[model samples]
Target: MPPLSEILKTTTTPNGTPWLTSARVGDGYLLRYAGMADFILNGAGSQLTCWRVEPGVSADTIRHLVLDQALPMVLNRRGREALHATAIVTPKGACAFSGPAGSGKSTLPASFFLAGFGALGDDCLPLVEQNGSIQVLPGYPGMRLGRDALEALSAASGVTAPVADYTSKRRALALPSAKNFPREPVLLSRIYRVVRPKEGEP
Candidate 1:
């Protein structure tokens, strides 16, 4: 692992804010959400750039500035569309879950992990084209679960970690209890659309 400065070199745009001098890293890339929005790549020019500031500077903010602002820049630069869902790859194909906030997109995928499926991504799922197939980036090793959702997962999987130990900056759980933690990104597969009914509806 390299230091943040070594791995990422900061540069100031004309307007004057720190942006990454180089962004690409190995098989993956880096998207910086500092003052302004910009994608840094090891290759030539930037894939995208944004002229907005994300909501919060704290690591615990739920309203992700990266997803809200930088994602569009990435999509436009890469010529892709954004999808609001969690993506998991199975033997059959890619599966994606899409719904509004609090619709269980995060918890349902945890169930999949307990069922022996690999963890793809949670919350912000990116759509990418690779090898003639549309693939979504597997999420980093993290899952964001509310109190109730966390308790339910604890019951079913018998895995529990301290809530305080989890950070909002990254969706992560350090569990020495059940020894269940995602180490890698799952392949993109199926797509599931989740819908929650209103106060009264069929």
Candidate 2:
């Protein structure tokens, strides 16, 4: 991996706070997430290397960024449609909830999980087309939820830890009895756009 010479791109939070910087390095790219970790992604999008690590950053925080953000970006570069969505498996197959940040994407899936639905993935749902149908690929074995949503769902027992020190969200395992983490891609059946309720609406 060569040194990141010049930044090709920089991404920010929904509120426009800078978070990630990317530079084209040789045939791949180097991504820098300030105060966390830097990842080197192969041009093929098949390999990821942790090029640098900042002291005191938890492994979980690095993992969260790799899976939830970095991986998705590279996958998109590889021509896969990586949606910012949460996928839940229902009797009808897989349904995805997609929206911008703070739009209940994870919370709605948490509710469905409590109701006995299996989860395919969260926050970076990858989709592949095969044999005339779109399939939803599985992501990490858990989802991240904010403190309030975790309390509302009564799912504290499954929480492994805080997703990162910078946020109040925690990573929680899918319910054991809910057929979690489908080993095979499930056919995508539908998609729903999720949004927060307007003022005075329940």
Best by lDDT: 2
Relative to the true structure, candidate 2 reaches a TM of: 0.91
Model 1: worst 10 consecutive residues (lDDT sum): 161-170
Which candidate leads the pack in TM-score? 2
Off by over 4 Å in 2: 177-179, 200-202
Give lDDT tens digits, candidate 1, residues 1-202: 2233434455664568664454545443556655534344333324433333355444333234444435544554565666777655466655778887678877787667656565555666666677777766544435666767766766424433332222332233432212433343334656788878887888
Backbone clashes in each candidate structure, one number apiece? 18, 0
lDDT by residue (1-202, candidate 2, tens digit) is 6866678988888788889999988888899997788899888988889988899998888888887878898888889998889988888899999987899998898788777788888899888998999999888658789888888888876745778868978888756524556888899999999998889999
Measured by TM-score, how close is model 1 to the native structure? Answer: 0.54
| Residue-level lDDT for 137 in candidate 2 | 88
